[model samples]
Structures are given as C-alpha cells and as structure tokens.
Target: MMIDNRLCGSWDMISNDNFEGFMTALDIGFAVRKIAVLLHQKKVIEQVGDIYIVKTLSIFRNYIISFKLDQEFEEYTRGMDDRHCKSVVTWQGNKLVCTQEGEKKNRGWAHWIEDDKLYLELYCEGEVCKQVFKRINS
Candidate 1:
C-alpha cells in the first residue's frame, strides 16, 4: 500500500513526556494544561508543491503554521514556544525534521512512525519530550 504522507490525520496523546517537567513550560496554568492533556488533537496537513500548511486543532486550542520545505522563515509559536523564531522543516529518511531558532537552545522537533504508531519528539532548553500516538481508522 502507498501512503500520501500529506493528508488529514488524527492523533491521540497516549502519553506526554513533557520535558519541561512541569506544565508551566507553555506559560499556561495548571488547569489549562490539565485540559490540554486530555485534548484529542486532529491534524490537517495540506501540501502544494514545496509549501505546506499544517493545523493542529483541539477543543482547547488550535495552532496553524505554514512554511515552505527547506526554506527558512519566521515562526511564532503561539501556543508552544510563544516566541518569534526562525523555523524550517525538511524530510529526512521518512521523518519530518523541524528546527526552531530563538532564545532557547537545542530547540527542534521530529515526527515519524514506527510499527504503525506515530511518534513526536519536542526539544527545548536542553530537554526533550517524547510523545507517542496511535493512528485510528476513519
């Protein structure tokens, strides 16, 4: 079977290994984080040529970002980093690699699949959060 790689997707946050060691990392309060933890995120990804727009939506909040592959652009991490930074994403061996440049060091993230399971790794401030998700059938 062949996979398009760019399509509407859904992910359930099975476990969040928030590297921040606390919910304050996003600058949100405990209550918000609690709700966020329970949030079921639906990802809508649209790619046309070298450009892509990805949206992460949930009842709690929604984040939308658009960028061109391998091109450097300014990104504002509204709900995540909450800062303006240079960002870029490219495909590396079937995995999507993203790098964010800003005040924080060692900041970047990657998404890939293994055994039909989706995985996400977020890094910042020398910390990393490993999250696992399982795809569901529509």
Candidate 2:
C-alpha cells in the first residue's frame, strides 16, 4: 500500500499531550525539556516516489529525517534528543508507522491524517506523546 499523498504538506502543532514524559524517557535535560515544551513545532512532509523526507521545525531547533518505505536507516535525533537509532518506516493502511531500534525500548511513532488535522503518536519506553497538527500549507 502507498501512503496517501494528502499527507504531504506543512502542518502546525495545535496540541501536545504527555510530551514531557516522553522527553524524560529519552533522558532530555531539564533545561532543554522546558524550552522544548514551549516551542511551536511544525511538521513538513515531502514525498517523491518511494522516498520521504519529514522535517520537524521549531524556533528552538529543527529535525529532518529522510527514508524510503520499508528500508532501515541510521537516524540521529540531534537537536531534539541526542540519540542514535536504526529506524525504518512503513505504511500501515494510510498511516505511516515508524519503528526505531536503539537504546530506548518501544520507541516509534505513527502519523495519520484525520479530518483536517494531522496526528502524531510518539512513544518511547512506556511514555506516549500525542501531538495534533492542523494543516497550515499544502
């Protein structure tokens, strides 16, 4: 199955829940966590054939990750959290599910679009962070 092209665009974060817990699980420092929680995050997704480039942009920092479907790649969570992970993204129905293998257990994220909003379910260890983004530009 292919990822819905509707997911390609720029989305602005509207709500974030349990993000602090998720950041703590990643061992983020207290100062960084505080700054991170306050920043408005934006997600930009670009799809070309089977390759996908996903970028998370914020005033404090930006994270850009690129990968092809079903292929594993080395992912470095640089500015967000300093972690090295082996990550693979695949399509599950219309949702983009990513599995991350590294020091943290149960680390992954799923992205799906519902109505006019984009949803992201980020999980690490036992903590789950839910973020909702509204379409800003397409």
Best by lDDT: 2
69-91, model 2: which lDDT tens digit per residue?
Answer: 89899999998778899999998
For 40-137, candidate 1 gives per-residue lDDT tens digits of: 67655566666777777778789998877788999998886478889988877767778988877767778787777777787776667787776656
Q: Where in model 1 is the C-alpha error above 4 Å?
A: 1-8, 19-31
Q: What's the distance in Å from true for residue 124, model 2?
A: 0.3
Whole-model lDDT values for every prediction = 0.71, 0.92
What's each prediction's TM-score?
A: 0.78, 0.95
Q: Under the 3 Å rule for N, CA and C atoms, how many clashes does model 1 have?
A: 0
In angstroms, the error of model 1 at 105 is: 1.2
Total colliding residue pairs, candidate 2: 0
Which candidate should be chosen as best, given TM-score against the real structure? Answer: 2
